[model samples]
Target: MRKFQDYRDSVHFYGRIWTAAAILMLLLAPAAICVRYNAWPAASAVLKGLLGVAPIFWTTGIIEVLTYAPMLGTGGTYLGFVTGNLSALKVPCALNAMSGAKVEADSEEGEVVSTIAIATSSIVTTVIIAIGVLLLNRLTPVLENPVLDPAFDNILPALFGALGVVYIAKNPKIAAAPMLFMAALFLLVPGLSGAVGVLVPVGALIAIGVSRVLYKKGVI
Candidate 1:
């Protein structure tokens, strides 16, 4: 708890700054894409927004950063943040108004640099979130049906499922059985999905476990 609190304190301002940067980047992504690809600016803007928010569709930074810490080494958390968030946002984010840089592969201190970039991305995300709140305030009165709020909730599960499948495919030996087992557990346990929000993970894990086990035992 203390460590988390400390991290929060240290990263708070940094996060806010990054979020502001991201909003600017998102706003400018369309123009850049239009120039680069000779695409329509409005269409490009929509695409850019979709891509910018794609990471949120797949996984929250909390989950991505947390999940990778043990997977990498001492610098795992920072690296994970970089890779995960970029995987979320893609190259359009780095080139324009958000203007964060990529980790140069040849640079020895790339990890430290990447950490800074990830922190900035978080800041950009925060700004976007604030904007979201404002948009919600404007839209709230018109949206009486909670079901139609935003498609984000549904899209996130689908995106995560796709990513999980990729991860499972890449590392089936270790990821397969445990994932399925946990998912089955999630299902069998009464009210577990509602309790722990297990549907997405459960489905992803099951697919991985089934695919790997079938492949391994020559069942498929």
Candidate 2:
């Protein structure tokens, strides 16, 4: 217990320091760009931009924290959030790693595995992105080719489809209701497709509720 408490304390301490530094660097970059280019937007214009996206971004950030923290553990949460791209990359990578390692998330072993997975993912992603940028001229035509556009467009669905099959196979009782609900929702209101981010919490809530009911009924 003491060891775990100490680990948590250490994580909180260093996490705060690193997170603060990252925020500072992010803010500084734009400020430096504005200063160097003599192109600072008006305060009102900045406010307008913030107003337009802040609500959605803030909501998504809060939802991600709630949704991912348990699966990621403290160290993983700290590093993953700092690195960004949680849904598209880090979260899935950590989950897959934990699954393969047969570690229950939120356990000590899970924390270690998740952290390792996220760290490796972040490093690999950075290297790949760097290489892609360096080869942008040569790769642009291939990447932007119309013949390959459909593959690019379906990448997210393809990724989640494979992941969904794995997880659903493991916990079909818990997954079934939410999957059906989301599928029905999209079919009924195709227009909401653009707002999937906002719907994440809704699906989570539905799944939780369904799972709770199933548990009470001893169905799963």
Candidate 3:
């Protein structure tokens, strides 16, 4: 009984309640109209893409989130160049079931069109976030040590910090050169943006090589 009380005290139940309340509110709200009208076939295509990818991503946390956004933007933009809307290109976001935001209607080239905002772009995102936090706080403790949260939370920072050090130590002459190279490569390389799953490390290595070459010649 004392252990249960201690767990409750440490876990912050109001936060969970607040989260559930927020998600409940979002569930009760009206979403953008086109989503309501669009055939499930359209929405299903989008949902499959997003849901399939989201779970694989859940464990990656924030860095993956930050990196994937730009990468997918680039990839999706290029993908738009081919396969067309049958690829569901215009509404890349319809892929997720959780998003409920609306897009306005517009006429283009004698066509009327509308888009479903990405699930991430929905006004209800805050509720999803709250629910996620609530679930994490409520559930993780049952399977793991509570203190492990604070400790494991620091892993990303530490790993990136170490990476930064290795980067600097490996190439001290042109600190910004590798960064600029990566940025440029990500931008200029055809179909390379969303490919960051492949591009980042490749770009980083190419950047390091170029920076080293430039530094050796004192041109950087």
Candidate 4:
């Protein structure tokens, strides 16, 4: 217990430092661009844009913390936050790595594995993105081919579909509730597609609540 606790503390300490540095580095790029080009927007314009988007970002950030932190734990969660794209990439990568290794997420090995997986994913994603950017000119014709559009459109669905199948197989009753509701919601209110980030957490909350009820009633 003492050793794990100490490890947890150290993870938190360094996680926070990296998270802060990531934020600073992210902002520095834009700040440097504005300085170099003398292209700073007016304060009012910046505030206007923030007003339009900040609430959505703030809400998603809070929801993600509440939803993702528990599953991801301290180190993976911090790394995910720094790297960004948790819902689409890092969370899946970390969870899949842990599952593949047959490690309980709360175990010492699981924590280390999850963090390493998240970091490795971030590195891989960065490399892929760099390569894409470098070869973008050469790849543009092939990438923009009309035949490939449908495949590109389905990429996200394909990734999540595989995950959904595993989850439904594990516990059909618990998964069914959120899955059905989410399917109906998007079908009925197509506008909510733009709010998928907010809605994903909402669906997770529904699943959690349904599972709790099922557990209490011995349904699971």
Candidate 5:
């Protein structure tokens, strides 16, 4: 218990430090650019721009936190959020690691596993990005090849599809409702594809509701 508490405290301490640093670094780049160009926008203009999109971002961020935090745990959540790209990369990686390790995400073992997974992922990603930058000229044609465009576009779907197959197989009953609903919704509306992040929590809630009904009926 003492060790677990210490771990939690340490995670919170460093997580806050890194999160603050990331925010400061993000602000600094724009500030430096503004100072260099002497092109500071009026406060009202900034507010106007933010007004159009800030709410959507805030909604998505909040939804993502609620939806992903349970599976990510504290340390993993902090690292994943700071690193960004949670939906596409960090979330799937951490979840897969926990699943592979057979650890419940709410447990101490899961926290440790998640942190290691996310940290490893962050390091590997940075290394790859650095290498990619160095070889970008050489890789550009291959990366931009029309033949690979479809593969690039479906990367996220493929990642989730693989993970979903594993989890859905474990709980087909619980997965059925959300899977059917989402499949139909996407097949019909299609344009909501851009809003998958927001829809994730909605699907989770629908699954929860369906599970509750099934449980009450002693179906599963």
Candidate 6:
């Protein structure tokens, strides 16, 4: 018990330090850019731009914290949020790693696996992105080629399709309602497709509600 407590304390201590440092570096970059280029926009204009997206971003951030924290554990949460791209990359990478390791989320082994997976994914993504940027001149035409357009457009669907199959197989009861709801919603109101980020929490809430009702009735 003492050793476990020590590990937990150390994780929180270092996680806090790294999270603060990451935030400081993020703020410093924009500050440095504004100072060097004298490119500061009007305060009101900046506020207006922020207002346009702040609600959705803030809501999603809160929802992500609630939904992912239990699965990610402390160390993973700190590093994942710092690295960003949670939905598109970090979360999926962590989940795959944990699944491969046969560890349940929230367990000690799960915490370690999640942290390692997210950190590795962050490093790999950074390296790949850096290389892509460096080679953009040569790669742009190939990336933009018509032949690759459909594959590129379907990447997210393909990824989610595979993931959904695995997860639904494991928890079909919990997955059923939300999957049907989201599909019907998109089908009925195609315009809502563009606001998928904002709708994530809506789907989450629906799933939670369904799960709670099922649990109360001993259905799941």
Ten-residue region with minimum lDDT total, candidate 4: 159-168
* Highest TM-score scorer: 2
Task: Go through the candidates in order and give the clash count of each.
Answer: 8, 0, 3, 0, 0, 0
TM-score, model 1 to reference: 0.39
Per-residue lDDT of 59 in model 5: 91
Which candidate number maximizes lDDT? 5
Error of 2 at 165 (Å): 1.0
All models: lDDT?
Answer: 0.52, 0.90, 0.45, 0.88, 0.92, 0.88
Between prediction 3 and prediction 5, the one with superior TM-score is 5
Those runs of model 3 whose alpha carbons end farther than 4 Å from true positions after fitting are: 1-146, 179-199, 202-206, 212-220
lDDT of 6 by residue, 31-61 (tens): 9999999998799998999999888788878
The residue-level lDDT of candidate 6 at 68 comes to 77
Residue-by-residue lDDT tens digits, candidate 2, 111-216? 8899999999999999999999999999999989999999989978998999999999988999988899999999999998867767877888988999999999
Clashing pairs in 6: none
Stretches of candidate 5 exceeding 4 Å from the true structure: 1-3
Local distance difference test, candidate 5: 0.92
Q: Which ten residues in a row have the lowest lDDT in candidate 5?
A: 1-10
Q: Taking the tens digit of each residue's C-alpha lDDT, what string does model 5 give over 1-220?
A: 4788888899899999988999999999999999999999899999999999888888999999999988888899889888888888888898899999999889999999998999999999999989999999999898899999999999988998899999999999999999999999999999998788899998999999999999999998
Residue 144 lDDT, candidate 5, scale 0-100 = 93
Query: How close is every model to the real structure, measured as TM-score?
Result: 0.39, 0.93, 0.27, 0.91, 0.91, 0.91
Per-candidate Cα RMSD to the true structure, in Å, reads 16.8, 1.7, 22.2, 1.8, 1.8, 1.9
RMSD score of candidate 5 (Å): 1.8
Query: Residue-wise lDDT of candidate 3 within 65-179, one digit each (tens)?
Result: 3433332332222222221221122333332211222222221111111122332334345566577678987866753788677767675456546555754675666566666
Local lDDT at 214 for model 1: 77
Clashing pairs in 5: none
